[model samples]
Target: MGEAIGILGGGQLGLMLAESLDRLGRDTVIVEPDPDAPCSTRRGNVLAARFDDANALQIFFSRVEVATFDSENLPSMPLAPFAGRLVPSLEVLRVSQDRALEKTFLAKHGFRPVKHAVVPRGADVRAAALAFGLPAIAKSTLGGYDGKGQHRLTTPADVAAMPADAPGGWVLEEVLSLETELSCVVARDGANAFTFPVFENLHQHHILDLTVLPARVDPALQQEARAVALGVARALDVKGLLTVEFFVGTGRDGVRALYVNELAPRVHNSGHVTRQACTVSQFDALARILSGVPLNEPRLHTGGWCMGQLLGDVWLAQGRDGGPLDLSAWRDFPDVVDVYVYGKRHARPNRKMGHFVVRADDATTAAERARAFRARLMGR
Candidate 1:
């Protein structure tokens, strides 16, 4: 077994993965640009360097047996030379980095995706708007996340108002008035792969607000989504976790169509619940795959649910200019609520400083308690 693993991105997801690695008796070396990143604060021996630097990554990759990323934005070309195991390989990155390419790839496989056009450099945005109609979205082909680098145009005027830099090498798509946004998280080791239950995602202001367990879709749709996800994993020859986001709604012709919205070539925000809800987690799955181990059949041991992404503005600390935002405040709550605080240096607006998850037997109770706990954690 590989003794050490190197992770490329040091967000809260990486923080949780670090803890999982420690529990598995494995060491983690996180390479991030921020010296005071929260993951580094809790985990020792983190290398504060840019993931895009070739020489730095070569040196960093030399020490570890395997490499994985918390997110997909890392430059895949530079790391292609690294000898260590890299999950969701460069081919995956090639297909996923460009929305236009991913959609074309999906369509080639007879999988339906939203109709989109590549806005390659100074193309008529108005033409795309005319083709796709109003209520379309212009999205950057790369480096976009958490609803960033995206423009929702409701009219021709909105299309005209697009930033000059925005239309360059981006994608324009006809926005579907969808019923809901859902994500399917799956892990593969080339031969054998395992998939988790679908997550019915709720977004508030373009940011994920909550994820409901065992998606509310019918069995047929759920199966379609899973099969599509597995096809994507296998087609890309992914060796680790892959999160595929989909838009679920009926088309103008009155037929149910699942449009793949985006793809994350690593562990995703929506899958954070697997830590407490499933016997094997995305991180653990990745670890086994990178180490040449077989995939484990996922078993949901308990009927548990998790809520995360607690905003920093709402979380406070004691004697640090702000009052106490201690977990001890929720001592009365059930132990099912797992608190994970990223040891970040600062708590700025919209910064994901930490997350707390509470599991329960049923959906209603879990939602109620999670909201209640969020209220208390923020001193609301």
Candidate 2:
């Protein structure tokens, strides 16, 4: 039998990656605990087991020549036995998984992350945050995303109000005064790297709501963001993809600068619009990399695009339990180019269910139309 690409997590990202691999006539093996994971149920070749299960890893490594991950949160120590076959290496995952380690590496390497202080695990979070000063954001150093494991400390008592337990430690970050959020995704093989266009991100309730391509910032800043993402991929020695989220901020001192917000070691949500907006989609880029296909720089396929997230809330708003959405409203928005609904089993508030992309003459206009499309779908 021929070799296959192994994925460590079977979340939506993994499912999408597997689909892209399939288009290339590549085989994929996924290891995930969820039997109903989108890839597990829909794509097959899944070993329904825990990430660190020794028996699962043994079976998993036997069939695949190389491995990658859908998430950076899994334990790297357990995979040390099979580390030789990992795409980006365990060290990359190790640093990117922990906020403290990620911050330290960036600073030590002369990259500026937002100013922050680390509060060791089991320490008094309130006191540490107080010392850092009020009007801060406290995030656990491990396994946080989409607003999870975050706390806002405004007054002296704000940290104490919720008092989130941080067994994995915490990082208290300085809040920015004002500006936009942006992200860049870099695709790399062993010897070469390339970046997608920088994306302007907007969030609601701390969850990524919309992404605008050809980011609404000075062209120079967009160029800088792309360069930063490629540099970080090189620093990590990435063999797949690395996404760097950024902050174009004016700090309290009233200084405007670009700061590294965080890193994701796989295809990102912001890059979803690339499916229709760029010559090569992020998923296809990674698939080609995994298959050792020669890389070519991707160019704009559309003038501009916007991708809007569809949370489970949209389903609940539609009064459905679990199934395809009522996309009857599509006739109203001609610019809405593509819609994707993941085969997730449950619908709960704030959970990402799927996404849609809109192409327009310009990205800002696409963003506006995407928002309106979602509102219409939600009956508002």
Candidate 3:
């Protein structure tokens, strides 16, 4: 009968958060629409209902002391009734869910973001594309992640092929040549905050492929990135976790610059390595904050580490007739520290199902070993 924490959106992130809460001797209630969501299967107290379901929210809020969401895309208006208990606040979610709003918020707060234009619903995509010029990215203002709801407009033909039923507004951004993509995760309570080390992230087909801890970027850039992340958390008055992803590249002035790419209002995929490499995992940190525990700064525990995502492609390679993955090869690589499978029943391309971490004396070796292990898992 201890404090029970309620989580909106029962995906893998919720599952991981539930695990952290359990270890801290707290109870968890997961509210999710899909019965097969990873958290639904793994947790005991689950409310199988849509996030916006009125009756579900009533029943769920009655059981928990505090509530948080795993994803930012949930309709904020529907959760207004429970505003008193939701951490990070609905205002934060509202801003994070819309690309246009997110960009404007950053710019208004004196943070630099990529130059962009907003194409409101029913607006002319062609006009917006022309204004932004070719080689721009057209992204739906809401409900898209991992490269979904996005298009690369390199030619007039591409713009002409725009989807007529764009569900929401759109943001057209000028494409910038990038040196690297980096992310920093910050956990906060009302009065204090802690930031994880900046991580250099690698993406393949717009999906996260690898994350290197202690990013090999200039030490000065790393410090600045962390500072920016902390500033964002403070500005939002966040009570959970906020992850700021940045693009490190040359600006129009030909000087190296850092621009905020986007913000994730919950534990981020890039912070997965913290579970193995830091004194406190991002999940644990958020769980503690929600449970009324004071925030603690997370310190790197390993020399270097790499987190490799296990996408649905790994399952598809099983050829349907193949059995479970042959994980015996892991025995040969002592540096591969942890393997986590989400227990999802089926896998489709680009869907994240699991992840693994590799530790070594340096970032390069850790990345190489992680990639080699992933290739072996795929039988490549």
* CA lDDT of each prediction against the hidden true structure: 0.73, 0.88, 0.88
Candidate 1, 160-220: lDDT as tens digits: 7887555226787776769978888888876887788777787766877666666667878
Tens digits of per-residue lDDT, candidate 2, 1-380, equal 23999889888889888889999988999998986567767545898888889998998999898888998989888899988888768888999999999999999888889989988888888888888887999998998988888988888778778565774799999899748999999999877788888889999999999999878899999998888888888877888899999999977667899999999888888888888899888889988998898777777775778999999999999998667899999999999999999878788899888999999999889999999999999999
For residues 318-379, could you state the per-residue lDDT of candidate 3 as single tens digits? 65322255687798889999998887777778888888999999999999999999998778
Q: Stretches of candidate 2 above 4 Å error? A: none
Candidate 1, run of 10 with poorest lDDT: 316-325
lDDT over C-alpha atoms for residue 172 of model 1: 77
Runs in model 1 lying further than 4 Å from the true structure? 1-3, 42-44, 252-254, 316-324
Predicted structure 1, TM vs. truth: 0.90
Q: Rank the models by lDDT, top first.
A: 3, 2, 1
Q: What global local distance difference test value does model 1 have?
A: 0.73
The deviation in Å at residue 124 for candidate 2 is 2.6
Better by TM-score, candidate 3 or 1: 3
TM-score of 3: 0.97
Give the Å error, residue 73, model 1: 0.8
| Order by TM-score, highest first | 2, 3, 1
Residue 137 of model 3, lDDT score: 90
